[model samples]
Target: MTTPHHNTAELAKLARVLDRQDPADLDFLATLPPAALRRFRDQITDLIAERESRRMQRIGAAAKLIPAPIAAKITEAAFGPVLAAAIAGSVDPARAVAIASALSPSFLADATVTLDPRRATALIAEVPDHMAAATARELIARGDYLTMGRLAGSVPDRVLRAALPHAADIDLLHVGYYLEDTDAADRLLAIVTDRVPGMLRATATENKWSEAITLLDLLGPTERSHLGNVVAHQDPEILDALLTAVTDLDAWDTLLPVAAGMEPSALQRLAERPIMQDPAVLTGIADLALTQNLWLDLLPLAQHLTPTQLHIVAARISAEPDDALTALIEQAHTANHWDTLIPVALALDEPARRRFAALPVMHRPDTLSAAVTTAATHNLWSAALPLVDVLPPHTHDLLATTIATLSTPDFHAALTAAPAAGSTTTLIRIVLRQDPTARAHSLTLLAESDDLESLVTSFATTDPEIWKSLAALNSELPPRLRTLLAAQAASCGHSDIAEALAT
Candidate 1:
């Protein structure tokens, strides 16, 4: 028979018992007879200590399962070093896999693994297809041809000679990307030499851009040089993937040369790809090329960008304090593009903003004010406050009004403005009026008020709610304030106030 008891009801009852009985609440027992409260305090302290000990025991038990010192070193070593060391050393593959598996899978798939030659050859014959593919790539990364040839016998040719696979191809690139010997790249390229550009075109039709790059990387630079031409004359979808893959300028330079070598119509077709359509990416490409001092390569694509991109490029080139930042700020302002200029201004701080403010476009107070207010709005206080003087005439009042509208206006204003005696008093009164339940929180602010004596003396009647507010702010108030407030209320013959205000 199934159990019929209500598990949820039992748990709810247990939780209610716990919530109603906090250990700190036992502090009230201090008012009880001395012996009784002392015993109660001891029991509560013992219970809390025991529960804390159990939590620490569970934490220590879990910590033992991990090799802490070794685990800490994993992130510092790049994937290539870690994986190659795992394969080359006499360590167990299972242990190595455990460590390597924890690394980023994308980097792992792309990193080289160099196995001990004899072990590499033996594993290829003995291991299954999946294991053999991993070991063979690692063997190639070692740049040992005899080992690679012997290992290749059992492996699939498509995996070795044909297009490299995705996440699966990471290991292949890992080998090829780091190889020092020229012959290694030569031998690697030789495998893909027989296939013409037609192979990539065929692959692209199948929406196989991922595999095509793997194959292209394996080819020597000369063989892959016509890629821009092939891509230019090809379908647009193929061109998109090719462009997205060019993350840096060196890759762009290689591809751009191939693109320039192609027919003009082919280049136009390549330009039609979605990757080339976005202004940000186009500008990023131009900026990247300029960074590499490839100004000539960047010239052909200059007109393709929007004004915003050109401003970004200007900001990047004017990297030093001299002229680039001024040019960027000017370009961004003319384009009505504050988003682009704000980053450049903040990047330099007071000196940069000072320099930018000196420029003709920044001369208008409103523009500089808007920039500062924008920085403040985003809580970039350091940036905003430094530009405070550059703000327009009316912005300070607007900033004040905006700050006062905050839910916790006193706290927010305290953060924005430097503390002043009179200002702090006014802010505290404003916050106290807004808080509907003005007990502990507002009472703490009131205690901090510079006019503390005046605040207390004005409340002559000693209302119980006010007494409760003071008491809740700190329990010590009951004994100290009770005597003085009770004397005042009794002398005034305010019976209701005398009773509530008494300790």
Candidate 2:
């Protein structure tokens, strides 16, 4: 979780557990659950600790007896950082501090990496604040957030306060990730709380969302939501960059949760971003959400989209295989996200909409009822009615029952509030089927559409598949409108509609 593996958060955590070792091991590690991976990490760390202790037992006697100055000289000349680390833990605590203080901060910092604090607890505790502070600076210079993070618990608070300001916001951001110890991570970040905004701006500027998401995950929810809001206000280019990184890394697990905590307007901005609407990005997001079961996180985002973006989402979803679409419906039903789900299904061209409505899975009464509930809650008659036109009889009956439950005033108000004009004919059919008493009222409301002529004309002039749709509703149209729709249907060679209207 501390590193940017440009993969799912699970694999990234696996990388963290493995300390970025053996790229090939990931294939094997991927098969294990998180708890198993944690156990494996603990065993590996323990094995290293035991082996390190056995490797250095004799060095303690030599260090205490040989004198500090001589040892420092030998350290610089013979023992490198790794061996020095192993020896430091075994020596008498005072002697260890003396030997460490005599070395340059650069060398101490290098050795500090492997100086298992669990073993060198005394030496780490006894080390002077100045020496620790100096070494922190050296580690930061080396871009070694890993060592700083691992030993943060052992570092004096005063030393950390002094040393952290020298680090870049990005460095602070990354250090937060490397701290596996929750207390240590919180202590380290608490010092730089004021720097969070700067940290985010730098992340956006650097397009480091991969690393940023890793850190955000570790910060837990409250902090993540705060940062998520800040990120929402970033410049358009930042979102563009985010889209690039998220898709490339497939880090949706982390990013989508952060996105969920954003303000409604912020979520709306993000949903409408041009790059976010890219068909490839949209399809990839849906497919990834489906594959990873991230629908719980992704569905809230759909609630923020405007109709324009709904069209984009609908177009992207229309191409999914029936099985894929069915899976999406299943997920939405599980999440109770059908309010948002219906808009995209309805926004599809009539052909795709018909195909989607015919999916056998749509017949589940529970699924249709949940969708109707969401649609009613959101007053999505503009969207829900169009898709209802293609639904099976049972679903139609369900929708009619829902309509029957609404008062005539509420029903007419819902019709009056149609958010778009595309669903006009479908709305008229439903009005006649379920509440013929509101016929004059709904027709009067729809009669004012400035685009009505062209809208109906296109039914015949455009795709033949769409022209045939009017035939189903023609008989429900009033005398003049029914005649006009029949003529339009016959002009498009759909005489079945003309004959039905004629009858």
Candidate 3:
């Protein structure tokens, strides 16, 4: 339609116009004839492709000469996706790693995700420790948990150690769960211990415990035990959450053994949690302890529980068939766990408490002393009073003498509990041997009895000093009761006690 030179000039002008305006602003181009528009679009596409190829060539050439620091700056200035593609396609892996190291860890980590997978793997494997840690934090912040999992096994131990402090528990758990190179994971966790000793516990508690349980299998026994120690040191709420997860998931088999390995103090802390007071939970733990021969391990921990918690354990254990109860008691005795068992015994229902008191093992003097001391110290006189009847006469005499050693409040508590437990004879014998200060309280208790006359007569004959002590209490005693005691002492031919009582 036009001469060739004129058409050439028109096409050149159109190209210049397209360049001056945005190539994307194609409204005017669309108004041109179809043939003209097609040629124009084709020319634009070819020119763009040629320019991009030349730019990449320059970048590749410049990359070989620039030091990593300068190269990092250049790459950071370039569009992120284009820079990623250029590095992946044209840069040597070693050089790429050097430049990546020089870049901001966060920026490089974002760029890394856009890189081809093979390139990313190669580059990540070579990142220096500091940069690797920075990248790990960036990945966590971005919630790129899957990528973190993929990279963790390939990262060095020092890098992981550096990074763990910055990691969130959720991300760490996610990575730990999926990391395939267990040996690498193990080394990584070990390094993590140096920086964040509680990482395993925090991660396990922050995530679904099933994932944490699966990750535990990757660890050796020592590491797992260390992790248990860490878990035991966590807050009670965290431990409560862990127990709830274990219960909800029915993962006791997986968890109890770990608990069994905890240090005594830590295990004691776990035992003292109110959550451990749940009857089902306590029963489950008890069954596990019995089956695993973990009574020695568990009893010390149980010793730290609150009385209410001990009561729950005692009730549950006592309700077990007689054989199980027998096994529990026998194991506790053999383990020298009386300090642990005494509280549980004191918390038992009357029938159960009496049943435990009747066990032949309770008669051993050392065992009896430990039980009586613990019960008295904790004010479990109700549990202790009943045991008096089961003691052999010599043990009874020993216990009567021991009761005399109690502090004032404990002494009064024992005397008050004795009559209710039908151990009045034991109390009477104990009173007969007590010092004046103790005998005064005993006299007050005896004065409440209808056999006040017989009690006074027996006391005057058995321990003449008790009458001297009772006479000292005349000012404090009710007049009528004092008169009765004096009349009884006089009739028994102890006019000395009668005369003192009348004063």
lDDT of each: 0.43, 0.69, 0.64
Best-fitting candidate, measured by lDDT? Answer: 2
Model 2 spans with C-alpha error above 4 angstroms: 1-45, 52-84, 87-108, 118-132, 152-163, 174-191, 203-225, 245-254, 306-308, 404-412, 418-503
lDDT tens digits, residues 1-503, model 3?
Answer: 11221232234334432544333344444345544643664566456445566676667667889898887787788657446554544567688877776777778677654343433466556667777778778888887654565456666666677777787656677667655445756775676665333554565445566667666655666677778788778777677777777777665656666665668788777777766878888877777666766666666667677777777767666766666767787777666566667666767877887677666666666667666776677776765665565555556645645665667666666656665556655556556556666566655655665555544444334456656766766786667678877887787677997888787
Ranking by TM-score: 2, 3, 1
lDDT of 2 by residue, 99-158 (tens): 877899988988987776777777777777778778888999888776777677666677
Off by over 4 Å in 3: 1-128, 131-161, 175-207, 213-241, 252-279, 296-312, 319-327, 330-339, 376-379, 389-394, 401-425, 429-503
Pairs that collide in candidate 2 are none
- Winner on TM-score (1 vs 2): 2
> Cα lDDT for residue 254, model 1?
46
Question: In terms of TM-score, how similar is model 1 to the real structure?
Answer: 0.27
Q: Show the lowest summed lDDT stretch of 10 residues, model 1.
A: 1-10
The window of 10 residues in a row where model 3 has the poorest summed lDDT is: 1-10
Candidate 3 has a TM-score of: 0.47
| Model 1, span 1-503: residue lDDT tens | 00111121122222222443333443343344433433443455346445555553453344345564453244335325433433322333344444445544334333322232333343323333454355444444544333343223333444464323321333333334322233454554445443434454555445544434433443445545555456565555556656766532225644554443455566556555666666676556656555554444443333233445445554555444546545545544554445334543443444545555455545454555555445545444433343443434344444444433434444343433422212332333333334344433444444454544444444454344544443333443334445454555566556565566664
**What total of clashing residue pairs does each candidate reach?**
7, 0, 0
